[model samples]
Target: MNKPYVIIHTHTSIDGNLDIMDLQAFEEASRQYQELSLDPEKQQFEIQGYLNGKTTTEDNITHYKRPELDENAAPVPEGDYVADPDAPMYYLAMDTRGELAFEENTFGYGGVPSHIVVALTERVSNAYKDFLRKKKISYIIAGKEQIDYDVMLDKFYNLFHIKRMMVGGGGTLNWSIVQNGLVDEVSVILAPIANADPDGHRFFVAKDPYSSIEETSFQLKSVQELEHDTLWIRYSVKKK
Candidate 1:
């Protein structure tokens, strides 16, 4: 394949909601999710990184604070920047508009270190790029306004040599990539409890601008029951 094999991995409720009411169960499920990522036998391919959308990164890492940018700074030379190309693992954040203010270039998951790679668009300010450079973070520009996931994935393979990418989402990102037909597999850790909140985040939500997205289907791949009544389900996206 020209691009990396994309896998959408997440923990969700029985109703396909991202919100789970049981904290204990959620933690257990999350632990299992991490284990699955490291299991050599289960992971036939080397997963170079985990990808997230801008909102998810902000909620979990940045907390919605805007980055201090130099609006009057000199324009940065255009192109992708790879600060640490040889890093073993990565934490790929899809911040199309360069909204994230990362404090560091590395993220830790399951005690394993991963270099941060921010995905940006041409519309981002030069100051944001400079901030990332100061932090030694890697970045890629793939679109003019919105993200062109296809081009981003291509660069991931050609530049960073990321052959297999695991996408850990917050609904909008998941649906966006899947709708673009970029995902290969859907591996979800099904939590036992559900928060029936109508406003709760879902496993996959089509963004407002993606109203014309077609209904996609999946072919069942496998299912395994985990502890605490949690379940692991894998599906192969049915490509057109």
Candidate 2:
């Protein structure tokens, strides 16, 4: 494949909800998830870094605030910017409109440092790009109004040589990549408990009005019992 091999890796309840009912179980499962991401024997591929959706990043990292942008500033040169291509790892964010206000260019994950890379679109203002540049954050421009997953993945591969990428985004972002046929595998750390909240976030959700959910099948690859009654299930997406 010319693009990176994408893996949707997440921890969810047995009912496929993103909410964690049992804090202990969630913490244990999360520990396993981090270990599994670095397990070379289990993954059989080098994981460059993980990707998160814009909303997830904002909720957890940026705290839902807009960056100070100078709309009247001079336009940045066209194309993707590579600030630290030689970093040991990366933390990628899907911010199509460049709304993320990043104060730093690197994030530490599991004691390993990762360079921050923001996925953007042409619709973003020049000031936002300038902000990223000032922070020394690298960014890639894929689509005009929205992100083109194919082009974005290709750029990730060619620019950063990301052979394998871990998709740790929420349900909407997960389903978006899966429906786009860019994901190679699905790895879920199923927590033993389930959350019955009707409004609970699911493992996969269709949020785009223009897109319809297709019935995608997966071939079971492996099942392993983990600590705290959590189960690790791996599935390879069946190509249509």
Candidate 3:
């Protein structure tokens, strides 16, 4: 059996908002990716901290928050930020499960696992099927009518050669993984800014609260201080 490693790399605010980014937040995420990346050259470029602690915008990224690439396949003409080497295979955009009306997309680089598996239900719409097909994205249906936990894990290890999976959540997907006990660890990067809406969406449970971990605990791994007033802290989840 392959040793599966799970980690959640995320940025949150003091009030638990993970929506938008300021300068420090972006840099910290970039640094984390740089550290986990397999490519050495890309790691060097990302660690320079040039674009550290800045807001992510259209000028810096594409339609999604992905960095805009030039025709030559370079991340940008300005700085040395290189795109993740394994982007094509690993980055997954998770659409709304079953409902084609409001699908979600998640874009990440090489730090993600080998399999970019989207957890979904079986009753997905035709529009979604076409969309995933056109995008050349593979998906897994969990619960009923799709990929369940054991089956998905088997596929991940056997087919995709995935020993580790870093799940960057969009609430529902996060809830799914946590509820299923698929996730083993979580790393939350808390920012200084507070959310404008007190009752707005949070990093974890908002309405349907699940059981908190009983035996699961975490240990501080490391903390990196950036130019901005932000702090990057990593925690290792001590499993039961």
Candidate 4:
């Protein structure tokens, strides 16, 4: 936790799926989260989706209601829909428990980092806070107010002094951190599978090209295999 250094670690298939089904990465990330998770309900929720939004009279919630991405916002670099630039990081996922609030596909790995710090708007619900807290996780709700990213990064660095911070994200979170040039390293795990859904999230670039690093590079540290014929590779991102 010397200073807030960022590392983007993600696993994707050639078909473009991102889930814990890639056993090695899944087990590694989960072992860490499991060690820290204290709440049984929250841990159970990881296996299922935590309920959000409206509930029916039968105490069941509907699935397949995909939230709309903001139109006024810029599209993702890969040219997919994007959210309001000012919006709290929209997690395009269901809770780990997989209870069903949105789509009903059994995808997503929800492994909590040592500290899952979220930069969200004040509009985030109390239930959301409770859910994270139940897992013994801490959060930073930037509130409806926008925080100076640099200042907030410094605070996170100072607060946790986390030696190595791994950022496992969907897309925008990765883009924002990379665009800001705050990341020190990045690890992209390319799985040999693909998703025919073009609208489904792409690994990185979508439309506009992002800023490039003149000296950005990585050194391979290790490579291993996981259950189900998956692979685990490690790289040390060259520090700028």
lDDT of each candidate versus the true structure: 0.84, 0.84, 0.45, 0.40
After superposition, candidate 4 runs with Cα above 4 Å error: 17-117, 120-147, 205-221, 236-240
At residue 58, give the lDDT of candidate 1.
86
Clash total of candidate 3:
7
Select the stronger candidate by TM-score from 1 and 2.
2
Give per-model CA RMSD.
2.0, 2.0, 11.0, 12.5
Error of 4 at 205 (Å): 4.8
Q: After superposition, how far is residue 163 of candidate 1 from its true place, in Å?
A: 0.3
**Per-residue alpha-carbon lDDT of candidate 3 for residues 147-223, written as tens digits (9 for 90 to 100):** 35565555444454456655555444454555566666666666666657766446665223323433345678778
Q: Which regions of candidate 1 are displaced past 4 Å?
A: 20-22, 38-45, 210-213
Query: Clash pairs of candidate 2?
Result: none
Question: Candidate 2 regions off by >4 Å?
Answer: 38-45, 209-211
Residue 47 lDDT, candidate 1, scale 0-100: 94
Global Cα lDDT for candidate 1? 0.84
Q: Write the per-residue lDDT of candidate 4 for residues 1-240, one digit (tens) a residue.
A: 134555666666665555345355545544433322223444311211111112110122234443332334432222111122221111222131212222221222343212223333445444444433334333443324443356445444444333334555555445555666676656555554554566655444322332343434567876765445555566665555
- TM-score for all models, in order of appearance: 0.92, 0.93, 0.56, 0.45
For model 2 the TM-score comes to: 0.93
User: What overall lDDT, based on C-alpha atoms, would model 2 receive against the true structure?
Assistant: 0.84
For 1-240, candidate 2 gives per-residue lDDT tens digits of 378889999889878888656578888887788778855455434789788888788876789888988778788888899998877688989887778887789877666678999989888878999999889999999887888887888888889889889998699898988888788899999987776788998888888741457888999999999889989999988999
Where model 3 places Cα greater than 4 Å from the true spot, the runs are: 1-3, 21-88, 93-117, 125-131, 145-147, 206-217, 238-240
